[model samples]
Target: MQRLYARARRAWDRPLTAYYLVLGGSLLLTALGLVMVFSASQIEALQSGLPSTYFFQKQLVAAALGALLMLAASRMPVKLHRACAYPLLAASVFLLCLVQVPGIGHAVNGNQNWIQLGGPFQLQPSEFAKLGLVLWGADLLARKGEKRLLTQWKHMLVPLVPVAFMLLGLIMLGGDMGTAIILTAILFGLLWLLGAPTRLFATTLAVAATLGFLLIKSSPNRMARLGCLGATDPGPEDQCWQAVHGIYALASGGWFGSGLGASVEKWGQLPEPHTDFIFAVTGEELGLAGTLSVLALFAALGYAGIRVAGRTEDPFVRYAAGGVTTWITAQAVVNIGAVLGLLPIAGVPLPLFSYGGSALLPTMFAIGLLIAFARSDPAARAALDMRQPVFGRMRAGVRRKTMRRRAERPPSGER
Candidate 1:
């Protein structure tokens, strides 16, 4: 055990560790999510008179597109990313505003945060808004830091806080408290990363908490969701139906689970089995072992993101990475906690592991952002440079072997 720990420590100390962890962990979770989505959504799709593969096919296409986006993001220069900050944020804001327009906007499960794009496709602006806030907030702070303006409380909170509140207000207009919570998390994350004074942080937290409580109190649906925490009964009118079923799914999974694709809950007992409650289905089918594996992947991804943030010299990279980390981590905890009955069901999808193109696309791009930052590290860059020749030689050796085998082989026609 000691030897293993030492070996792991050494590996963790390597320059490229963060890069590989971010890449590998994100990919693994995505792949697993695709499998689970297929398994969990088939029943729902068929029941809706669609092909069994409908949801999975859509998710597959989204994953493909997201992969391309991630690759492009990873290859982009830091300057290009910074340049995109304002435009992306602008686009996100525009789309978010569009979602509030009667003819353009669409609601799903009471959240008026979507825009229907012809035929089975929908755009969720809030998802992109999360990304927008991270980039814009980071850039804002980075510039302020460079100007030494962050020392003043007003400079730190002025535009950033106001703009964040604007975005939050827009989101709340759609009645998406779940997303609102995530946006608030990102806001606090940015402030915390900027090393806000304790008093300011406390004040901000208090205000957020108060606003959240008021929001919850104002909406019956939101109130019911909050009241469902740790609830075993389905409540009057089955308000806790989804929550209770989620727990049931996990409870039945035991230690090793019932095996993949065999979840009974997905057969109509559980709601949103492929999206928000996918974790419960995962626990049911893959058991504690599978759930733990998923948790481990998230832990690795979060740890890698932290390493990237801590090791970076660039202020933008540090703030951006920290913000992304906080966003993903907070969302995951809320999602999994809700499934476990430890928290209220927030309607947030598990990051990189749920069936939502809007969520997955931005998240994969964020992973790419981490990858880019990891590569930017001086030591990581040097290590990659050192590895080029070895990889080239290996490729050359494989080519030579293939050529020799081809030359020595009988022609297809002659055989």
Candidate 2:
């Protein structure tokens, strides 16, 4: 017990508060996600003539790989990452463009967004695009700060918003409103962190929101889904297949779940028992208790990510860390909320838990970046090694002068 306490104290002496929070939260969430994926995917898997552990097995592999990536990323030198930021960002953009090509890009659902690389591995350019933009934005913003220029904020939107829109346009062209929405959110968050003028942000946001609304309203499929949103009672099984089923699963679980592996909903009642709507499987199989547990896990992640942002001294670390957290946690909240019929039905995946290769890889790398910053912060180091600097000669000079003055002084009582 004493050893544990001492070790924990040593850990706290560093700026790793956020690092631990984000990394630990990510691991916890991944574990929980794996279990839920199995619970949720069983029915869908069975229906598709696959094994019960199919999704779980894949997710588990992804998690293991992600863990290694996280560690490698955390241990990587900060300068290397900074140096590679631009090129990585550019490559991600290029990939995003490639995914838009006819032969290269694979269509899923209605979105021609994924680039399938044979062997069950599908790459989503938008996923990499998100990370690239975050890294690129961080580097750009930091350089602006280094130059000690405030006016750069005005010109900042020029390249940034266009690049963001280009990514958004390409994603939208692929019919991925969810990815576009997420990209928009990330961009706005980055801009906010960059200290863009408030009035400009407000004006730009209104215009973009207006455009987003028009796009959604114009799409029949999106409009149909939007119609089901904000409903007091959803019928995902009827008009809203996913939502109604999710509600059923939640209601079935009641309190202490039907017990793990006891979910009937995974049998086929839920369209995507393991993927986007896995939360429903959790609610049905684990009940309200299970659902709450999952919620608590995410809450912990959000808190930890925020802690990391707060602990960092550099704006780049702070922005990148917090931005990644926002991308993941915010998306989770939106996904779960939409599933439970609390919000509109948008096809956003729950991070780390969702069965997508593209999302998992980038998310893992982002967590790695968070860990990297957390592991090597100078502020954290200074706090841990609180030894004052030694100035031997200067110290001797001051001490000798004090002694001489004292010796030369007349007795205090003489006056």
Q: How many residue pairs clash in each candidate?
A: 1, 10
| CA lDDT of each prediction against the hidden true structure | 0.94, 0.78
lDDT for position 220 in model 2: 86
- Once fitted onto the true fold, the runs of candidate 1 whose alpha carbons sit more than 4 angstroms away are 402-415
**For residues 51-142, what per-residue lDDT tens digits would candidate 2 score against the true structure?**
97887788888788888877888777767777877888788778878887888999988888889788777788888888888877777777
For model 1, how does the per-residue alpha-carbon lDDT over 237-306 read when each residue is reduced to its tens digit?
9999999999999999999999989999999999999999999999999999999999999999899999
Give per-model CA RMSD: 1.7, 13.3
* Candidate topping lDDT: 1
How far residue 384's Cα lies from its native spot in candidate 2, in Å, is 7.2
